[model samples]
Target: MLAAQRRDLLLARLRQDQRVVAKDVAAELDVSEDTIRRDLRDLAAAGLCQRVYGGALPASPAVADYPTRRGVGVASKQRVAAAAAALIQPGTTVVVDGGTTALAVIQVLPTTLAATVVTHSPTVAAALAQHPAVEVYLLGGRLFKHSVVTCGAAAVEAAQAVNADVFLLGVTGVHPDAGLTTGDADEAAMKRALARRSADTYVLASAEKIGAASRFTVLPITAVAGIVTDAPADDDTVRRLTEADIPIIHA
Candidate 1:
């Protein structure tokens, strides 16, 4: 098959099976594995797919800019947000991560619920301004515009001082094999730092993020308390996550 044909078939397989194994596709196409690997490399460079150890996985749309992502997964984000927001109890402290899904969470939190929220995102902190009962703690640092979250040594240092009952984490991708991932190195580091400070961390995974892969891994799938997602329960990704014993909280 031609290289263009390979790209189309590879992407199709990624959509259907959630991943494309290089050898498997090579055998099916009667082509050499090197050729398939080259195709995967080109696709990855174009941002059309995320290359993994063996082959490729679907690229997450969540890697887009903050404003663009706001319109990408609206309903699914709301579902997962509501589910994650439900985990916070009154008088408890929670760390809310930065992302569109995390932003949606602010809309679901009860205005009367008294709680403390620690965050590295100025966006999240500003949204909580109207909440009369909740106290917001903003972690200061260099702003990472892509996700609109604070990062760098200052943010990681601030995270160490926090002790939260729960952390509503967000990532660009949630896969059984690829684990939890995001697009930026600093954002991933910031996420890991916050997870350490919180007793439990639950990922806010909307439908679009499921089965996708990003450039940098934030944490292993098992590191999280549970995955809160609106993706179909029977989805191959979801099924594999269940098989791996990662808690799946259906939104």
Candidate 2:
């Protein structure tokens, strides 16, 4: 019931759920929403959590490291991955960007599906390596340590050689005005090249990623042909994308 106790409890909940809503915490701790916000702010200042709109999220979710990213958002990524994987037809060359979402797509790839997958993420390459029916092409370049994806001039050049049917882009943020953005400059550059080389580009994002903006811009909304998310297509966000002329597919 004390401030320190409440803060500790809130952090425990955030660790377990990956995020915590202010209203829920307020009710549980018999405090006002403002008080919960103060606690969140204090926690964030202490480097204990990252505050989101209505709540706080764990400072580091999956993707902080390769091993940690493997299981984060497993169900949602699986659904998104399944849908993205289904888009690949026989004999198609596809480019999967470097993100946990794209890695999820690789994990659920059907044994019957056949295609050449181009990616810069070591995690994704490792996943696709187990698939005998798929041809995996690892792009070479300087490795981005946080995401464990290759980027730089070499990787960009390697992406230019292939004309892919689809580029499955993993977005850190998707806003109507900001379009698609990411947190890394090198990754953004690589994604831009992948989009240019592919005939069609699809963005895979979770609901939380919608309306968010990161530090680096990748592609604009018009550049993406479709967006696949875990939420239902009838959600307001899906309708917004539909109105904007971007096709929305529910995972």
Candidate 3:
């Protein structure tokens, strides 16, 4: 088959199965493994798939820009946010990540719930301004406008002083193999810094993130205490996570 036809087949398989193994596709198409790998490489370069060892996984749609993400998964974000909001204890401090889902958590939190929140997202910090009892600390740094979060050496340094009870993390994708991932490398580093300062970190994963992969990995699934998601129990990603004994906090 032509390279274009082979790539089309790879995309079809990806949409159907959420992943494509190079060897399996090669054998099925009666082509060399190198040919299949080349097709996969082109697909990855085109932002259609995330290349992994011997295969590729579906890329996430959640990597869209800040304003665009506001509309991507509204209801699912509410569900996951509600569950994540419940994880913050009454008097404990929490480090909240930046994203639409994290902003949803701020909305779901009770007005009178007393707590401390440290965040790098100006949007998240502003949303918490109306909270009667919660103390908000906005980390200062060069703003990464893609996700509307602050990141750089300055934000990383500020995060070092934070010793929080928990960290609510947001990422672009949550695949069993690719682990926790985001679209930007520096944003991924900032997330890791915050996770390190908190006693426990819980990922805010709406249904859309499951089964997807991104360019930069933030952390492995095992690094987190649990993942808070509204994705169905029978979802392929959820099923894979379950089989691996990963603790999932369902919304």
Higher-ranked by TM-score: 2 or 3: 3
- Per-residue lDDT tens digits for candidate 1, residues 1-251, read 77898899998999999899999999999999999999999998988899988898999988999989989979999999889889999999999999889989998899899999999889899999999999999999999988899999999998889999999999999988889999999999999999999999999999999999999999999998999999898999999999888999999
TM-score of 1: 0.98
How much lDDT does each candidate structure score?
0.93, 0.79, 0.94
Off by over 4 Å in 1: none
Candidate 2 stretches greater than 4 Å from native: 1-71
Q: Candidate 2 residues 77-103, lDDT tens each? A: 778888887888889999988878887
Better of 1 and 3 by TM-score: 1
**Candidate with better lDDT, 1 vs 2:** 1
Q: Name the TM-score of candidate 3.
A: 0.95
Ranking by TM-score: 1, 3, 2
Cα displacement (Å) at residue 114, model 1: 0.1
RMSD values, in order shown: 0.9, 6.1, 1.4
